[model samples]
Target: MPKYILFGDYCENALEKRTPYRQDHLEGLKQQKETGILVTIGPTKDNTKVFGIYDAENAEQVTELIENDPYWKNGIWTDYEIKEWIQAF
Candidate 1:
């Protein structure tokens, strides 16, 4: 499995609207982890962005996961970047 990192940029009002969608978002990540695709996920200290590590065959798989997220579809996330990660540890 290849490891990749995803960076999600929040919309201007994302924080204000997060409460309603938060549970769904968390549930989605939990499902991904249970399915053995997600490695780890969380927001930055300021909550302006979120970063996730995923285990997938390639960048396309990780992109599909991001595209399927509630946050992405519901407009909470405005943009994203994905890159293959090489863990030294």
Candidate 2:
């Protein structure tokens, strides 16, 4: 498997807008965690952006995972970028 980093921007007023889909988003993340795909993820302290690290076979796998997340489907996440990572730790 390869490691990837995800950077996502939230929609305007995401804190308020995300309320309805929060549960589903969390549930999807939980399943991804259990399946060993999502290594770690969270929004920045100010909630300006979302950051995540993923372990997957390829970028497409990670893209599909993110695309299926409720936040993305519901427009809480406006856009995102994925990059193959080289972890030096």
Candidate 3:
């Protein structure tokens, strides 16, 4: 499997209206991690950005996984970009 990074920002209105769902979103990611779909995930320390790393067979698989996320499906994220990543450490 290869690894990729997903970079995104939360929609302002969604952030304001769905605080509890935000926690659910994170819990979902944690489940994915336990299932071996997610390598890691977190928000930037300053809180302006968010990202996730995943181990997948290909970019399309990664896209499908991300697109199905409650956060992405509910418009919690305003924008996102995905890129193949090389993990040296």
Per-residue accuracy of model 3 over 1-89 as CA lDDT, tens digit each: 78999998877655475575677777877888898979888777755577889898888988887788777788777688889999999
Q: Using TM-score as the measure, what is the rank order of every candidate, best first?
A: 2, 1, 3
**Model 1 Cα lDDT, one tens digit per residue, 1-89:** 88999988888767787778889889989999999999998888887898999999999999888888888888888899999999999
Candidates ranked by lDDT: 2, 1, 3
Candidate 1, residue 46: the lDDT equals: 82
The parts of candidate 2 lying over 4 Å away from their true place are none
TM-score of 2: 0.97
Tell me, by lDDT, which candidate is best. Answer: 2
lDDT of 2 by residue, 12-83 (tens): 899999999999999999999999999999999888899999999999999999999989999999999999
Give the better candidate number (1 or 2) by lDDT: 2
How close to the true structure is residue 35 of candidate 3, measured as C-alpha lDDT?
88
lDDT of 2: 0.95
> How accurate locally, in lDDT, is each candidate?
0.88, 0.95, 0.80
Alpha-carbon shift of residue 67 in model 1 (angstroms): 0.9
Please, what is the TM-score per model? 0.91, 0.97, 0.82
User: Highest TM-score: which candidate?
Assistant: 2
